[model samples]
Target: MARLNMRRCPQSRNPSSEKIIDFYAGDYEVNDSPIEQVKLTVPITDNPSEPVLTFRTWVLGLTSCALLAFLNRFFSFRQNPLSVGPVAAQIIVLPIGRLMASTLPTKVYQCPLTKWRFSLNPGPFSVKEHALITIFAGCGAGGVYAVHIVIILKAFYKRSLHPVAALLLAQTTQLLGYGWAGLFRKVLVDSPYMWWPQNLPQVSLFRALHEEQERPRGGVSRLQFFIIILVSSFAYYTVPGYLFPSLSALSFICWIWTDSVTMQQIGSGLNGLGIGSFGLDWSTVASFLSSPLAFPLFAIVNMLIGFILVIYVMLPIAYWTNIYDAKRFPIFSCETFDYSGQVYNVSRILNQKTFDLDVGAYNSYSRVYVSVLFALNYGLSFAGLVASLSHVALFDGKHIWQTWGNAKSESEEFGDVHTRLMKKYYDPVPHWWFHACLITSIVFSLIACEGFDKALQLPWWGFLLSVAVSFIFTLPVSVITATTNQAPGLNVITEMIIGYLYPGRPIANVTFKTYGTISTNQAISFLSDLKLGHYMKIPPKSMFIVQLAGTIVASSFCFGTAWWLLESVENICDKNLLPEGSPWTCPGDDVFYSASIIWGVVGPGRMFTSAGNYPEMNWFFLIGLLLPVPGWYLARKFPTTKWLGKIHWPIILGATSKMPPTRAVHFWSWGAVGLFFNYYIFRKYKTWWARHTYILSAALDAGLAFMGVFLYFALQGNNIEGPHWWGNSNGDHCPLATCPTSPGIKVEGCPVF
Candidate 1:
């Protein structure tokens, strides 16, 4: 194993310093060349032979995986859900790794039945091992969204699914994506230009942890700075998180004009555009668009533009203009309604025997209607899908083709330093390995779908078709996410295809959609982790084994947690049935249920066909298909004008993507922070910005996760309520924030219990 030389050269500290020696590339002028600019010169080879599959790795990995799985599922049920993203895991796992490295027994522990022996203490806790642990934790960090199938069946529909059957469905849906990701490693992971910029922060943190280096003059050490910030943040959150919940959504405008519904519509953070509202909670700001502190400046700007156009301009115009009779419905709601303005009676339209749509009942009842925001969400989703495909082809197609041609060639000089380093280890995981995983996953999925009491009702061929669609969309969406942090989701396209193919069965439609859409997302996530492993120089075979094991652990824990929560909480998705201040409101399930009704039950034919009530919605698909052509043409024709390249339509459409769960306040505040830090401060202090930005983001996330866990167990878990006061109440100070203003629309006064 080659040792990484740590001795400092003159060029190591500053890129612009004179008489600088280039360690990686041959000696060259210090003047900036975009391709030659090196952000991280840290050597890739750092104890390549260090033990990765040690007792410490397994113990920590399994513990964190289970903890994250539980926490993610627990928070998903909250009214304002908070995600424990990969960054949080990356930050929190560091000290645990270091502590274990120092304290764990060094003696090799041998398996009684086998010849294999593994040590608990891997010398000094190598960066590669630390990264592997983080990867394992990340695998289970997100609650399986496919579990929504089980949630809706039991909670809202009052249908029963055996625990065994539900667990199998959840596991199959989650792991299918891993197989897809393995198949696409060549394009998404191996290619140098697919930077996966989001991983840079973690890489930087890894270096900060493992590398032997002195702190800058008068500046705080990374670990010291991290601890200080984490402590302060954890203490501060106690106010908005528990004692003063009203601070989470402070709408001064609504407070001033309590009787004016128009003011509330424009000012309320929870129920409207939230133009004047502000959130004190860091979790609220970071929930929708990830932490502004972590995003690249340009990406943040693109998000801001899209958010303004969609939320501020498009949404308000549609609502005030009474498009889809928006005034009759709540301005921002995921719930579907009948034409006569009542909660949609899905039971009346669902055939009890088959769980399929009853055409007679659907026709006899009034036509279904959606809020203006909901209608726009579909249009944007459609437009975003087309835009992402076009953007990648026009901009990155040439580079992709060139990389594919040279992928296997040893003489390829265009590869990045990380790629070059990885090539030294010739033992690549063979293509057959990935193929085997895919085939096995498919076989098991067929068993789950066909074996059990027709729970999913999706045919084997439908499963195969969903997989094929996932394969097709994987490369394009992966390219978009690699270059830009955003992923144009496959929800619209998947739903459209399934709706047309298997029309009347809601369960079958969502099940197919889950396989098609969630699988692609999982593939992208897995690929991102692979990129992380690549950067850290973890052995490919080891990475493959650990990732597989982690997924299995995550699936088991997720199933157990979901089952427990559903059994414990009464009327999980119903606000009226649960206690008034209970945090068990399942908002995510509400959205999932609505989607099943719109696309699965009513379906594309009844919703957008000529004889349908919402026939005009059909134009959105056409509009989306043609929307990106002009932008692609202009950018291709005028390649020198760099400003034209900044316009990414997919990102713009993604801004208003999930309105029910996210508010305009999130985008506005997030963009403001990004503009100040990522754009302005970054330009002025490049080195300082590079050093502190990611560290700050990690600290904030870790602090929130730690505090959230403590609060949940201490107060929420034991059913201990905080002192009842105006500050601790649910709403912002104003009671009439969501009151109806339109004449003849009966006003439901805001309840202030």
Candidate 2:
């Protein structure tokens, strides 16, 4: 084996200089590419002369995440049924799941098909190992199946898809995502300035796993986790989703309302609602956009304000003024007070977008919000960069400079031979690689999408317009989402785009009319991946592959599943099926509309006339737009701030899904739990108990995935076309036309007539 070289230095007595030099010394290397390392490792492994991870181990690692994904989809208790929705859940669950498996004797890794055909020596419950598997599963089989089961099976009135096909789709998608990521590992991961914060948790876990192996083993505990997932899944399938609704408090409430129609219509729909259901209203979302309470401490405050001003304040005002709905003042279209004090058409109002800003009613709302947020975020993110550097300059500036200089240093385990070889043959790819990869991926995606009949039917000019819109919209949107975590601004950007390009098309018609507009969403999602890579210490090159893999996996299946689920509907009565009022009813529409509307309305701004005036609501949406900044600023001021720093903003950012009355308490509580587990359980009890958090999380996710899958299949209940439960069907319940109906299904009185 070749050796890595360490740079020798003259003796220095100055402590500050010494520290800086030493810190960065390791970063300096002749060659820093992981791809080259891969090539070298390949030769060694293929020689049959050097020890390497066996094929069986590779398969075991790969399949583990898949298995977990399947379980999560089938057994979920959250909106993201696969339980991979929240980053915190992933961090907490995956390790625990793996640890649970770890404690289960050799049978855990046993191949279900061949049964212990091959095995590798133990590596501790590895964060990297399991995470890779989870991502693989998520991107591959999980991604595809998620779409397929939700769309095709449910749409066709089938209970489920062929198991083999589901698995194949999942695997293929994952592979593709990884392949794409591989092309841009350098910029996303290797760049020092680009450390994605979300990745740090994973890196810490991975490093700890390796370090812990040297310590005595008390073994990982899986009791609480294992039982939780099992019980959760069982409960999910047995309760509202499968068996008739039964809840003591709810039952009492129902009794007070003797009207079965109201009860059946309203209460029946409760099953599909999650904790975040309360916050889905325009007021809540708008509030979040403008509130400065939610901003990160380290992020600049002014840019956030600007963003809020544009979307929450400006666009809402615009849209409400007659942009989209000429005759309405943006009230809940379905909100009707009963003459006798009984609710009439309550569902329609609940179903309609509030203030005409609902993503469903007017495309402008989504576009304007996202666009302004993106622009604001892009502008504000620069401040974050300044903040980060200034913070470092004040504190760890020396260390950063050292790390920068050390990029030329040799690997610790390697000697001169390896170092020389690395210098000669391996070099870390540059940041430009990602730019190139982005271009290529876009091209390929366009090509692939063009092959689809519906997508291909788009005019060539429309396709070019879509790309232009995506390029214009996604960059800023990605920056905002990345820096602030709240992307309410996307709404504005999307509306502007759609309103400009496909001017008279219904918001629903944009996807069919524009071939590649959705790429804006994809770009942002991809950028999030890169953001994650930056935080973690994973090699930039390695991260490129990992992220690309996940993306490819997601892309391959996301659209298909979205399409299927949107088109499929089953029992209209089943709340889990496209409930009378839920965003999931129109799965892809919000995202697609966000882009199309932007192109149509804002892309040309004053130049191109719009079909209708955009609606205007209150400027309250600007509140949360600034909220994230203060918090970010405070964080930057106090990087070592104990309680706050311990709270991973990524998770908190995700928690924005929760409504305000509940958001603060939930965020802090969850943060408390996470911090306690990470610091106390994992760190303090480092010997055994806490190390397997990811494994546990994986198991939980698996259970969740399984439940979600089950709901998608079984809940349809033989109905082929009623309402799509998974996404954007815009109908309540299953999409099936002939779903079983009860007398209570009739409206109390028709108000629409």
TM-score of 1: 0.93
lDDT of 2 at 545: 57
In candidate 2, what are the lDDT values of residues 1-753, reduced to their tens digit? 333333333332111111111222233423222322111111110011122233322454345444444443332322323233332234444555555446644432566777565434343444444445434443333333223323323332223334333333333322322323333333223333333333333333333333322322443223444456445644553343333222101222223434432232222212211111122211122212322222333332333233234334533353335233311211111111222222222122122222112334333222232222222332333233233323324333453344444543533432222223223333444656656665564454444334433221234455456555544433333333444444322333334444454443322123322222234444444554543433322233444455454444344345444444443434321334556543233322223333332333233242123431222221223433433456556767887875443232222222222221222222322333344544466446543322344434433334444554455566542443333343222222211111112222323332111
Which candidate should be chosen as best, given lDDT against the real structure? Answer: 1
Q: How do the predictions measure up, each by TM-score? A: 0.93, 0.47
Model 1 root-mean-square deviation = 3.3
Worst 10 residues of 1 by lDDT: 29-38
Cα lDDT computed for each candidate against the true fold = 0.75, 0.34
Each candidate: RMSD to true structure? 3.3, 13.3
- Clashing residue pairs in candidate 1 are none
Per the 3 Å backbone cut-off, how many clashing residue pairs does candidate 2 have? 208
